[model samples]
Target chain A: MSLREACECISDGDVLAIGGLTIHRKPMSMLHELIRLGRRGLSLLVFGGGPDVDLLIASGMVGSLDAAYVGFEILGFAPNFRSAVERGEIKFTEHTEYSIMAGLQANLLNAEFIPSRLLLGTDVLKSLGYKTFKSPLTGEALVAYPRITPDVALLHVQRCDEYGNAKVDGVLAIDLLLAKSSRRVILTSEKIVSAGEVAGSPFEVNLPSTFVDMVVESPLGAHPTSCYPYYTYDLWHMISYLEYCRRGMVNDYLRKYVAGVESFESYLDLVGEDALSRIMI
Target chain B: MAPWTTDELMIVCMAREVENGDIMAQGLTTPMAIIAYYLAKATHAPEASIMQLAGNIMVYFDEPPQASILYNEYRAMEHAVHIFGQNEVYETIFKRADSIVEFFRPGQIDKFGNTNNSTVKAGRTVRLPGGFGIPDASPLYKKTLIYCPRHERRVFVERVDHVGGLGLNLGGATSGGREIRIISELGVFRVDGRSGGMRLMSLHPGVDVEDVLSNTGFELSIPENIPETPPPTSVDLRLIREKIDPLNIRRLEFLSGDDRLEALQKILDEELRIWRSSNVNRPKAQQML
Candidate 1:
């Protein structure tokens, strides 16, 4: 499927689960397409966040965020998301990274909530309304992290087969859970291979075809963030992104790199081959 | 040798926390924790295993790799002993809760050692990077060590604005131990499991007790006689400077503003020079795995 066509499946107010850890293999191409499509009222579900979540928040499409983190690491706070929350622009429900994972684990098990020892004595219980239930088996009190089932999950990987079997280099993060827990899964990849090739090395296939709904082959799909081995994160671009967000020029960034371009190739052209080459490992 | 910086001193303190055959989980953007684990594995805890949370690779390298923002994971993966998925990372932590010791750099920590890497101002005013796995895992770890690069009233609060991680009380009937030690520029503090209060462990050299008291937002439990925190030995200094982290990337945690950016660029430049000289871009593999 094409990027635009895959994005068209998403509707406004959809619960969207974003794949990848902070500053790693985020689905940048799909996010750009979603921006171009102008989808709004999105409830973003992510375990770890970075510029992608900030950019989506800046796009004014996000209605609420259920996340563990959203930051630029050593650089500073994620400007757009931080300012938006500070100004009461968006409803943000924070969860610890474990809660996010546990929620997904519950969903995978078809359970209402998973009992956990975490979140006890922490303010997350009062803030998020996670109830403390006594386990029937042991009579021990445990925090019940509710299941998280997103409407759609967007992921980017190093490679995928047309049959929807995919492989990722480096960290998988929560992408696998996002794929399994979400109702619909849309994948973007740097390369598309034949089924025979993928089957020959079946052990390498981390994501099976059964879970994938659509696969779009888009090279440089994880630009700015890393796809590892293939390329490292473009730190210079991130530095510029932080500056643009700090100066409240996100629209200009969108124009120059995302919406201004006709396609992903054009976006890459604007980023320049030399710039991309510098990040390639 | 030159006088050791506080960052190096803290790294040595943190490294001392890890025992032999321990599993230290390294989280994202933690250059100091990364080096501390490497230092431990290279020195006393040669059997210590490092679980890279960001890269999802388990390793026990003979020598630590250079710490770079861009290449930390890639370089770690090169020496991968066991490559696993994200779910396994959590499962490993849970299964080995009694043997794991993790380090965190909380945005705000309170008297009871409750941390807040989430939003500040009672989760309303200033937004901080949400606590990744600290809250959940801290309760289950054998020991939780928090290192604050700059110690001040802002960080050492009477009560944190939000509780992203539980402190001294290892809640529930988990097999994990009750141990939370905090190291700051001023000194070291340990939270009492019974009272759930912060107590002065030791003051770093050249730092007065008054300095620590004034900087802390809450009243600290001080003993009758307080000894100075031992300075880094010459061997520890040598290992950190000459072997484990020659680029001094661990200092990044202590830096902020323009100074941080400048330091980061210098490290990146040095990394790029080394990377370019050694790595030959293998032709894109046909199988794509």
Candidate 2:
């Protein structure tokens, strides 16, 4: 399916999970397409996020966020996420990384909640209303992490087959879980290979075809953030992006890189061949 | 012997925390901890398995990759022995909770050893980049060693505005039996399992109890004879400077203000230069996979 078709599957006010760890392998190009299509009111479910979450929030697309972390690693706080939460513009619920994982695990297991030994004696637990239970056998303390099932999950991968078996080259940080747990899975791959090719190496397929609802062949789909083994994250581009966000010019950024561009190819042209080459591994 | 800076001392102290056969884990934006893990892996703790990003996506590496902001998941691919997903890694860490040694750097910490990385609130102000894995996993590790580059009053607080991770006694069974240590530029402080407050374990050379007392926001329990923190051996210094971290990536945490940015830029430029000069072929788009 086309990127547009994939975006069509994502409706407004849906619980969307953006896959990848912080600052790596985000489905940015598909997001750009969604922005171009003027998507709105998304409730983001993320474990570790970076520019993808910030950009969505900055673009006024995010209505609420349930996240573990949402900041640029060393560059500092995510400008839009911070402001939105601070001003109460967006509904924000914080979960530690493990809790988010536990939530997903609960969802996967068809359980109401999973018992976790984390978040005890912390303000996060205090603010979240002190939900705890004692283990029946061991009588140990545990926090009840409820299921967090997303309506749709968007992911970027190094490669995928026409049949939708995807290969993620680097860390599979929650991408597989997002694919399995979400009600719908959309993947944007750098290349679309033959099913035979995927069959040649079944062990490498991170997401099976049964789980993927849609697959779009979008090369350099994780630009700005990295699609490992292909390119590193564009640091200079991110710095400029941070500058734009810090200066309260998110609309300008969206217009220039996302809305203003005719297509993802044009976006690439703007990013330029040399800059892309420099980041390519 | 060349004189060692505070950052180097902190790195050495941090490396010492890693037991010989322990499995140590660290999360994002931790060059100091990363370097220490590498140093430990290369030196005293040869059998220690260093899991980057806690167990997110990357695994044990034989050599330290060049520390570039660009070199995260990308470089992890160069040598990762086994590339497991986050779920597998988390389960492994949990299963080995009784033996794993994890390192953390909280934004703010209190005398009770309660740490906060989620936010630092001042009046209505709240910080972002919420605790990634700190609150969730730190309490479960057998040894949770925290490294704070700056030992200022602001960092060592009376009480963290939020308890991103539980303190010595507050964690109950999960965190109670675990050993917690704070390695700072001044010295090493340990959470006294009995008192539930921080006590001076050792002082870095040239730093006295007065300096630590003045810098800390709360009172500390001091021993009768506080030993000086052991300085880095010549071999350790050589490994850090000449081999593992020639780019001086470990200094990022120690620097502040404009200096940190400038230092980062320098490191980036050098990493780019080295990459450009290297004989490896850049993978074309189609061949990347």
Candidate 3:
């Protein structure tokens, strides 16, 4: 199916949690389609930072962020997130990656709250306006992070069968949990394999087809970011993007990459063969 | 002998801070700490376990990970047993682990050892990355070491624009012997265990007292006799350069230029290809196990 068809799975103002840890397997193809379609007033749910979050803010897609962190990790400050925060353009529901995971766990378990010691000595509780529940047995204070259910989950996997059984190679970070916890899941894959092929190595099949709603083939989908076993992250591209970010060229960048290109295919053409091949060694 | 860069000194100093039987955690964008964690493991603290670059808990590698925590050499993960999911890993780091220490890098740091990845400019207006996982799991670590490559007034401030962490707690201190230390190219700064204020613990060689004072954003504690940070021994340098990180990829964390990064990217690609071919996930002879 087309990128547009896959993106139709999400609606504007929906709380969308995108996958990947910093510069890992994010669904760039789907995100590009969302940008082209001009989706607005979104609330983002994510654990770590990367170009995806910056892209959302640069295009004015995000109104509020239920975020743990949102930088390019080692690469540096996310330009749009930084600029928006500096200018007071966005609202943030503060979290650490732990809280985000705990919150997601609550949603998965259908629980009211999850107790934790994550916010012990920090202002995350007061500012975020959450509370802690004492253990009945021990009377020990425990922070209770509220449950969160993203309206949709967007994730990129190494492989997915026709029916949407995703094969996650290497570290199965939070992609498995994110898919299970969300109301709807849209997976963009590097290769679309037959369910038989996936079934052959059933142990590696992380998320059963029952969990996935849409499966779109997106070769080299996790560009700029890494998809383990395929290629390392294009560090040059990240640095170049971060340079644009540092100089506050969010619009110029969006104009060139996200908005300027009509689709992910056209965007890939602009990315050039040189950049991708370099990361492939 | 080739002269060592400030990063080399910082890595060595950071390595010495490690103790045996310690489980240390470092985040992304923290190559120096990652190397130091392994350097400790390779040297005196052999019992030390590092959180591998890809967030694998209690994993060890014979060589430097081609990158950092995210892309640890999976082949070297022969010791890889007992996978910890993201939640379990942080839970282990925070609540369960004993003798835990974590290394972190914040965009901005303050007098109380409080670091901020939140924002800048003092009004909650300027946003840096949200606090990652620092606030929740930080209090659990027995010691926290901060790494800031650049040291100046803006880097070190009187008050962080936002408190991403409650470093030493100027008042209402906790009972745990929570220690916080910082290592930069210029000097080593340690928290006054009692006052929770920062003190100039040691100056790197050739760095003057005036230079350290001038660069700090707030007043720093200058003792009557401040020592110099000890340099890495010749044997230690050999272990770091040859055995631990042969590619010198560690320098890319700070000193990487376009030519170097381009080269590093290519190396990483090849590394991944190799890891894929010999991946443990695939069906194989299975006798290696």
What's the CA RMSD for each of the models?
2.1, 1.9, 4.4
The candidate 2 chain A region of ten consecutive residues with least summed lDDT is: A121-130
The model with the greatest DockQ is 2
Residue-wise lDDT of candidate 1 within A83-161, one digit each (tens)?
A: 8888889999988777888888888899999887677777776788888988899888888888889999999988889
TM, every model? 0.96, 0.96, 0.86
Candidate 2 residues lying further than 4 Å off, grouped into runs, are A138-141, B57-65, B281-289
What DockQ results do all the predictions give, each relative to the true complex?
Answer: 0.61, 0.66, 0.37
Q: Which candidate do you rate higher for DockQ, 2 or 3?
A: 2
Residue A55 in model 1: lDDT: 91
State fnat for each of the candidate structures: 0.65, 0.77, 0.53
lDDT of 1 by residue, B10-121 (tens): 9998999999998888876788998898888878999988888553878757777666676766777677888666678878877898888788898899898888887677
Docking class for candidate 3:
acceptable
Cα TM-score of candidate 2: 0.96
Query: Between which residue pairs do clashes occur in model 1?
Result: none
